[model samples]
Structures are given as C-alpha cells and as structure tokens.
Target chain A: MPMTIDSSEVLKRIEDAPLLSSSASRLLQITADPEHSLGEVADIVKTDAALTARVLRVVNSAAFGLISTISSIDRAISYLGERLVVGIAIDICASQLFDKPLTGYEAQRGDLWRHDLRVAIASREIARLAPQDMAVDLAFTGGILHDIGKSILSEFLTGTAQSVLETIEKGEAQDYLEAERAMLGIDHAMVGYELARKWQLPEPLQQVIRFHHKPSEADEEHRSLVYAVHLGDIIAMMGGGGTGSDTLQYHMDSAYTDYLDISVEQLTMTLLHVEEEFSKMEASLLDGKDGGT
Target chain B: MSNLILGVGDFGASNSPGDIVKTFALGSCVAVILLDPGTRSVGMVHVALPDSSINRDKAKERPGYFADTGIPMLLKQMSSMGCNVRKLTVKLAGGAQIMDPNNTFNIGKRNILAVKKLLWQHGMGPVAEDIGANYSRTVSVSTNTGEVVLSSPGRPPWKI
Candidate 1:
C-alpha cells in the first residue's frame, strides 16, 4: 500500500532548510535588477569568499577562452556581462546541492553536478539562437536545477531507490514518471515544481521545473520554454556521459516544433550544436587534471 | 536487404544496385537523407548539432555529432562512392521545438534556420520537409521510387 504524502508539507520543509542561503540571495538580487553593475554584483559575490574564488577560477579557465587573465570578481563580471555573471552565480550556488548521492538515480555525488552542468551548457548554447532579451537566464538556471527534485526524492526513497537503479540497469522498459509515481505516489517533476514554488523561484522557472519532463501538459503560453528544456534534457541523456537511473524515454512531441515555427532541419542542426557544446563543456567540467586555471 | 533501416542513434547507407534507406523518430535533431535516383544509391545522416567549430578537438573524436562537420563528411563519403551532388535529391525531417512556451532555448528553431542557411549557401535546398511540430516523426525515403513518407503518433502516415 502506498501512503499519500502532502506535497505542501514537503515544500514547507524544503523552504525552511537554510541551504544555499547566500547564493540564492545573490541570485534574487541580480534577477530583481539586471542593471546592477559588476561592482554591485561582485560585492554580493565577494561576501562568500569561496564562491567568489570559484567564479573567478571558472572565468579565467580555458573554458571561456579569454585572451587575458581575469583576476577579480569585478573584472570577471564586467567581461562576462551581468547576465552571465548571474548565471555563474546560480551555477556555483547549486553546486553544493550535488554533493550528496542520489540513490533513486544511481548518481554518484558528482554525477548530478556533471549532468546539470552539461544541460546548462547545452541550454545556453541553444539560447544563443533565440533573441537576446527572451534568452531568459532562467533557462540555464532551470536546466541546472531541473533535476534537483530527483536528489530530494532519491533521498526520501532511500530503500526503493536501489530497486529503481537495478531496474534501469537491466534495460527494463518503463517510464521514469510512472516508476516514480508507483514508488512514491508522485513524480519528481511535481516534487521539483513544489520545491521551486517553495523556494519562490521565478514563475517561468517554476513552470520549467514542473513541465520539463512533459512540456505538452504545461500551460500553452510557456510551453516552448518547457519544450526547450525537455529537448535539452533528452539531448543530455542521449549524449550520455552520466545519466542517473531514470530510463524512461519520452518521445519528442511534434506540436512543439509547429508551435515554435521550427523545422526538422533546424532541430537536427540544434541537436548537433548542443551535442558539440555538451562535449566541450563535459571535457572542461571533468578536466580536473588540467586544473582549468 | 533492399530496405536499409536507420534506427535511433544509428545511420544507414546503401549503394551499388541502390536500395531504399529509411530512418525513424526525428525530433529537434535533423535527419539528412540523400539519394541518387539514377544510381538508386542512398545515404542518410542524422545529426544533433549545428557547428563543430566550438570544439574542433572533440569534433574529431565524434564527427557524426554535429551538422557543420557531419554534413560535409556525409557528402564527401557519398560523393566518393559515385553519388553525384547534382543528382542527389535531399529530403529533411525533424527539428521540432521540444521545449517550453517561452522558448528560452529555441535550439530546434535555430537549427532549422541554420540548415536552411547552409543549404542555400551550398545550393542544395530541401526538396520536401515535414518539420517543427510538437510531435515526433518517423521519416522514410524509398530509393527505388523516390517516395518520402512521414508518420506521427496516432496519425496515419502521409507522403511528403
């Protein structure tokens, strides 16, 4: 027999937890006002010495391919622009969330981190194709945070998580949502949505968290963004450096292309581009040997 | 033996006597199908990215992953096998926006645009296309008769 857990209660518990407080605060401030200069943003980042160092290290790394070295937060922000800086802030903030293992996902501590970063990179590259303003920093943020609920759910279902992992490893045919629903009575997408709302993430991001796995069910207005993340997630899974235990494959919905006015050639081109981008980012992220600095 | 099927994550080709080459499940990623009606030689390359310039080093490791690199490579391979570019009738499928309403990351749309631009630049426009729907499609091209068909979920298969 399955017990019904109140999502609201779970959400409240997540909200009360003082996790990533400083990083979340910085993101809120940056998103609240994009005009804030590098100095202002840097001030917020500098408050967390460790985060500031990581940000600086990432910018100076070969990943960005800068001709000259970027030594300080202010310089890094100025060069990368406020939007990218905010993106980096969000990335650093969410980095800690991946420290714990996801039992339901068979993901080692760093696996989720790598997967999220790949999705973020792919999503950002994809975003480059859209109009600049509509790019929505939240896309990258959402891409990075989309799987957070998997971690949460995995933590909650410690015992059953192993079974799910075993099933996936055996190449069993099952939808991840169905399996999750069967095991926990609710899917990770819904749990992620609840957590997003509890955290007061932007409305668009909340929608992204809820519908990334099933964009067709999302509200018509934001369906395209949800579809983008969905595509990104699938591409990430297909690229397959490190996917967690979710083996359910969702077919790509054609209506999404019709709605967005994209064509088959375009989707192929984008997937290729995203795959390329993911490969590069994957190498960079895992290039611990080079130290990347 | 006559019908070469391209599975998900797989590519297919046929030459000599010429055979029908078919691929299924195209979404966001574009499937490039090339056929020489005269020789009946057919080849299809399904690529998932636009350009490989962003990471030339990695592209070398996986040339089939990007359109910019993969398309040229496919063309080169076909041409080397006696498939003339002029006789090559091209059909494209896939590139659907599988994302959210806001389209914060409209890679599918961008990819389609890039393919069009590339095709125009190279003087090879797509002859037939059924692309950019919220649905997934399975595309098949018959080298024997040059028939292109697209099938969607719960819907009857249609010719393009």
Candidate 2:
C-alpha cells in the first residue's frame, strides 16, 4: 500500500476552489425556495452582463429556432422555462470548470466536458422515465457534477496515475474508486461530495455526487435521484462518451432497477437515446454560439 | 500529421498521407481501421452497436454504427479509395466489457464476433490488435507510417 494523504489535506486544497458565477449562485439560492417568482430571478440574471450575454446568446441560438427574438431575460425565461434557463446558466459556468484535461484520469482536452455533458443529458432523460417526483434540474446538475472530484483530485494524482490504473487493470483493485482510496486514502466520490458541499449546492445534489457509483449506499429519500444519476453515468459510457483511464469500471446495480420497477430493457431503450439527446443538446445550445454571429 | 476523427456512428476514408485518422473510447463498440500501403490510403469506422436489425430506421441512415452493415459499408468506402479487398490490411481494437458479474448485455463480445464474421467473409483477419480488456481506448492511425497506436493512460501504448 502506498502512503495516503488524509481527508483534511484534500479539504484544505479544495477550500479555495473556483465556484459558480455569483449571479448563477444567487439564482440557485433564490430558486431553491418553492415560492419565488421566476421574474424576480430573471431580473437578477439580467444584471450580470456576462451572465446576461450567455443567456441571450443561448436563447437566440439556433437550438431554440425562435421565429421572433426573445428580446429580454424575462421573455427568454417565459419561452424556455425557469428551470432550463438556470440550467443553461449553470451549465455555461460548469462547462468552464470542466473544460480542462485531468491527465491523471487520462482525459484529453474536452473529454471530461463532453462526458459530463452527456451524463447530464442522460440524467434528464432517465429522470423522465424513472419516478415522476425526481427534481429535473437537480438531476441534470448532479449528473454533470458527479465527476467533479476527479478534476480536483487529478492534479494530486498525476505522479501516481500510472500505478493506480495498473492496480485496477491487474485486478488488485475492484474499480477506480477502490484503487483511488487504496492509494490516496480518498476517492473521487467523497471528494466530489465535499466539493458540492463547499459550493453550497443543495444537500440532495451532494448525495448524488457522493453515491452515484453506489446508489444503494445513498439515504432512502434520495435513493431515486441517485438511481437516475447512476444509470445516467452508465448510459453515457455506452454512448461513446466513455473516456479516460478509468473507463467503465463502474458496475450496474440491478437492485436499484428492481427497487424502482424499471427493467433493463426499459433502461436500455432510454440509454439508446443518450447519444441522440447529447447531439440535440450540443447542436441546440452549447455549440450554437457560432450561429448568432 | 493532422488527425481526422470519426465520432460515434461515423465512418471515413482517406488516401492523403498527410492525415491521421482516429476514434476515441471504443467500449462495446469496435473501430475497424484499414490501411493499404500500395495506395497509401487508410479507412476507419467507429461502430457503436452490434446489429442494426433491431433498429432498421437507424440502420438506413447510420449503417456504419452496427457490425452487420458497418463493416461492409466501411469496406465499400475503402474500396472507393482504391483499397483492394485482397491487399487491404486490417487493424481491430475496442470491445472491453464491464468488469462486473451483472453485465448482461455483453455488447463487447457481440461486437467482436460480428466483426470477425464479416472479415471472415472477406478472406481476411486483423493483422494486429489490442482488444477485449476492461479499459477505454483512444486509437489513431498515421497515414505517414500506417502505424496504429492504442493508448489507455498508464497502460503501455500498444502499436500495430
């Protein structure tokens, strides 16, 4: 066993990590309460020039195919719905964080970003087919941020990435998380959970980051949400977004399917649409910045 | 050399010696790479599923995404690029399965079997490969050297 760093050190390192845009952060805060009016939130989004520019660019982007211009943040919100607009803002912010390569995990430029986006897309799809009560935007956010820990821990693991992957490849470790723990005394899931907490995201979303790889371990109330993100992770891998050294080391937990009364066939069909959904999302919103100018 | 990438459900052929062709992370999917030294041409496809029979609608549009239609379609593309079936050397990679007992799909094995059957019909086989392990691979073929390199992080680079 290699000498491992303690959790405290990892916490201290991430203490100053980059977080969501202040406008996006306040937007999440105001929207978290059930009673807030969307116009109030849109008014806040309208104030941040950078945030407003992103929203207007996405709203008018070819993805929406709007016949008439949206004209304002409130009009854009009315057209796309409050959840997705916030999602767009959060997505733009998250995309910046995910753009870099995590070499220890062997992610090339744009690999992690693509994978996380696909996962977020898959989670939105899975949410529809799973339990009806699953929070829509939360599911998407959880999916995108599920692997944030890998990005955080990657810089620390560069020297040992080889040995860690070798152990997993050679069967000394069961999977990437196990390999990470044995070598570093911490794993991506826990680190990701901590990062989510530090970002002041809702608790349920934090649970998703922590137990996505092992949904059974999540608390009862959050089990369904965890299931959606978990299946989303697997489907993203199936869709060819599966990159990095760790690859598909994650195992599918059938118990979640059993618990949720969803069949593998049902799950598989939903999964088949993952690539299509990703393409649609990419073509519509993310890459459509080119369409405006 | 510049790189030409074939994303999922994609296929491409090139006779240009200045371009390298590549596809990333072939899990259950298979990447069939063909190189013809005589013409200095290379053709590649990233096959995402085993058989398109289940989804005939998709097969009509994306025949290169399935084994039955994809491998043949890839061969036809290579043929258009002056690659002779008898002279073309093939390289195969990807088909890693989930390292879990509950992995029921076994799409990786199905992909490999399907590719082998198609190649058998053509009287050819993979000249070199590094396949069927539980790791995602990024594979590239340089038109300059006709060398295919498969890498998975810490795993030593496998060259064909």
TM-score (chain B) for candidate 1 is: 0.84
Model 2 misplaced stretches (Cα beyond 4 Å): A1-3, A19-23, A26-49, A62-67, A78-84, A91-96, A260-272, A283-293, B54-57, B99-105, B120-127
Sliding window of 10 residues with minimal summed lDDT for model 1 chain A = A240-249
lDDT of 1 by residue, B8-35 (tens): 3345567735466776556556777777
Give one digit per residue, the lDDT tens place, for model 1 in A42-128.
777778776666667666767667798778778876765554555555555555555567755555676677677667655554555
* Superposition error at A51 for model 1 (Å): 2.5
For every candidate structure, what is the RMSD over all alpha carbons to the true structure, in angstroms? 10.3, 3.3
> Which consecutive 10 residues in model 2 chain B have the weakest lDDT in total?
B98-107
TM of each candidate vs. truth: 0.58, 0.86
Clash totals, every prediction: 49, 0
Q: How well is candidate 1 docked (DockQ)?
A: 0.05
Chain A, model 2: TM: 0.87
